[model samples]
Target: MTFVKNVPTQPQILAWLNHVKLFEGLTQDALMPIIENANYMDLKQGDMISYEGMPLSSCFLVLSGQVEVYRNTYLGEEKIFGIFSCYDLVAIAAVFMPHNRFPMTIRAKIDCSVLFLEKNSLLLVCKNNPIIMQRLLISFSAKLYELINNIDWLTSSSAEQRLGAYFLSLSSKQGSQFILPISRGQLATKLGMRYETLSRLISSWRKQKIIAIEGNKVMILNVTYLDELTLPSQRAF
Candidate 1:
């Protein structure tokens, strides 16, 4: 995979995350309620943090490095849901879901540092920090919006439109040139198709001059076309 711009050290990255959107304008004492009960854990590469069946409590904030959320698809093949990086909140659904079990497994793509807060501790944090809590509600709502947007993207006019929508998501995160975080197989899983199908689609895309893939770096040659695909019809008569 094409590498992300090297982020700072773990502690520095942690500090950065602590100052992010949800935590912004919030003093350490304001977060002290949750931070006090939170434990900072280091993970070795390829280590699995939470498995599918086990119950989960505390949510993880990826303070440093990248992580993969994946599980076995209905087809019995490993499927990647997404890649999470610094400042990304993990295990959110389990914290609020009915069963309280992680729907997917979390694996470290590289050495990682995550802040874990216990259930009671998180509740206390919310109880104490109303301002930060408001911001969190906004953040959670934004996640729901993102999922809804994904649904819209899936209902593309054509196969190329679907592929274009996918690259747009990556570019939004990684800048103009998107570096895919997973292999061809895992990407196929994310796209809900076989590897060969995705390969053929990419081949056709290259032929159509929509995108150019050299290794993991996917250069968007025509954003106009991709954007047009993503933006639905305006109900013009």
Candidate 2:
């Protein structure tokens, strides 16, 4: 972890805050105070952004790159909860909880920069600002929905079915042709599948000519084929 100096100018900070949906209606002047109290940090790959059970007092905004949020199971195995990328805000709920401790360990997936804002500073701003409070409520609701979606995806079906759905989602997200940002092992763990199982699934897909893989980059050759893999129970969603 490296502290970032030369913080962005007020205008730059305001521009960024404006782009964040949570601050949708906040004015430049309204955001200036929060920006003034913000601390920026640069993190390299493998750096731990936050540790499980650590007391939380700040909310983090990803300036660039990605962070993997995960928890350790009873057997000490890592269970990835989410991957946060650029412009994503994390730990907002934890910051306001009475217990106020991190439930998962957060680690940088690659070199990244993040803006940290003190919880109290943000709460103070929101207290008297109905617009900001509404925004926070909207953001909180979005996160809650996402959490439920993740739980559904995890227990939906077989690894093969899940993998197929994941690939389709990625293709849709990155415009049908994009390189995977994370390693195969990390992805395997994220999808709740064994590393070997993931490799075998990829191999099978490749053999079937459903996708073309060159290193980390994958091109979908058969989108319809992939979509047909949806399980009966998953069809409604």
Candidate 3:
């Protein structure tokens, strides 16, 4: 339940819902009811939207800025689950799972704008709008598939492979060089490493002539090697 302090106008909320790729399946006509049922909630920079272990009440759609999902373990270290940017949906799992409660604490990684949709209202939208319902089902299925792929990176991997995967994910944005959107600490959370350790590893990769790093720009010197490093022997993602 973290967010920025900006209150969004109706046009802004519509723009956000339209921008999100998952909602692309809905026509302008089809998206109206969901919009009608949705509520616009604003939060300050350090505000929490949903706490760990809370009942899943509303799903959030990011209108601007970023959010971090993290969990604290026995040692009190906060392990980030992920950092989501504009047009991304948060509380995705909770939206579809009746058995689900929020599993982690969500905080604004930076100042952000977000919209909240209550569960029953969301359900009514789906039930009444067949087009949205169909899209939601398909989108949920695709989400599950993507989650399995994400688990692959976490459960098993070599150092080289993880770094390669990181660069590849960045490369998907545009061009041979792109700025990483997330911070070093958030990247460490996704990569399952300490922040300082991840920084050293990136430096080591540069020294090894694997890639050229300038600020957030990482130029892959050898895509072949990077692909080899990130993908496992028996699996290709």
Candidate 4:
């Protein structure tokens, strides 16, 4: 990990802050305190950004690349919780938590850059700016709902169904053909399945011409069949 010695200029900071959902409609004046307190850093792949129970000194704004949020199970295996990409703020909710500590470990999935926004600065700004506080609440609520949905999906859905739903969700954003952003191993962990199970399912899909995989790229050859895999009744046969 490399800490940037020079802080970003106000204009540069404002440009990036404007893209963040939590600061979407805030004016330049309203964002000054945050911009002043933020610093930049670069992380190489596998660099640990924060560990579970780490003090919430600051939160991160992803400027580029991706970060993985994961926790170690009692059995000592890593379970990926989520991936955050550009413009996503990581661990902002932890700032308001009673314990003010990270709940999971965060690491660079690939080489990445992030803006570190100081927690005290953020809280002070939010105290005087109710709009910012409101936006934070909204972002936290949305994330909570997404987490609940994921719990339901992971526990109730079959492995094939889970993979299909994941692929379909990616396809919606990137069309029928797009590179898998992370490695297959990472994908398997994110989907809550063993690596062998995921590989076998993908292999079966390949032979059936449901999807084609070339390296990390996936092309959906049979969109309808792939979609049907996500439906319990349709997969009975």
Candidate number with greatest lDDT: 4
Clashes of 1: 0
Comparing 1 and 2 by TM-score, which wins?
2
Best by TM-score: 4
TM-score of each: 0.81, 0.86, 0.76, 0.89
Worst-scoring 10-residue span by lDDT in model 2: 228-237
Query: For residues 1-237, could you state the per-residue lDDT of candidate 1 as single tens digits?
Result: 222345344444436547567666656666665655666677878988888878877877887888898899777878888778887878765776788788888889888877666776666766787985787788888778777766665564455566677788789877778888888888777766667888898888789888899888899887888898766622332
RMSD of each: 5.5, 2.5, 3.8, 3.4
lDDT of 4 by residue, 138-178 (tens): 87787787777778778988889888988888898999998
Q: With candidate 4 superimposed using the best TM-score fit, by how many Å does residue 182's alpha carbon deviate from the native?
A: 2.9
Error of 3 at 117 (Å): 1.2
Structure candidate 4, residue pairs in collision: none
TM-score for candidate 1, residues paired by index: 0.81
Question: 72-183 in candidate 2: lDDT tens per residue?
Answer: 7676667777788898888877877888898889999889988888888788777767887777788788778877876786796789888888888788789678778667
Off by over 4 Å in 3: 1-33, 183-186, 193-200, 214-217, 231-237
For model 3, name the residue pairs that clash: 1-48, 1-49, 1-50, 2-49, 4-43, 4-112, 161-229, 161-230
Report the C-alpha lDDT of model 3 over 1-237, residue by residue, as the tens digit.
Answer: 433456555565567787876566556556666676677655667688778889898888877788888887666667777788877888866777767688789988777877886777667667766776677678788878787877866678755567678788778676668777666766776677777878888888889888888877778777777776765633544
Q: What is the lDDT of residue 49 in candidate 3?
A: 76
- Cα lDDT listed for each candidate: 0.74, 0.82, 0.73, 0.87
Supply the TM-score for candidate 3: 0.76
lDDT winner between candidates 2 and 3: 2
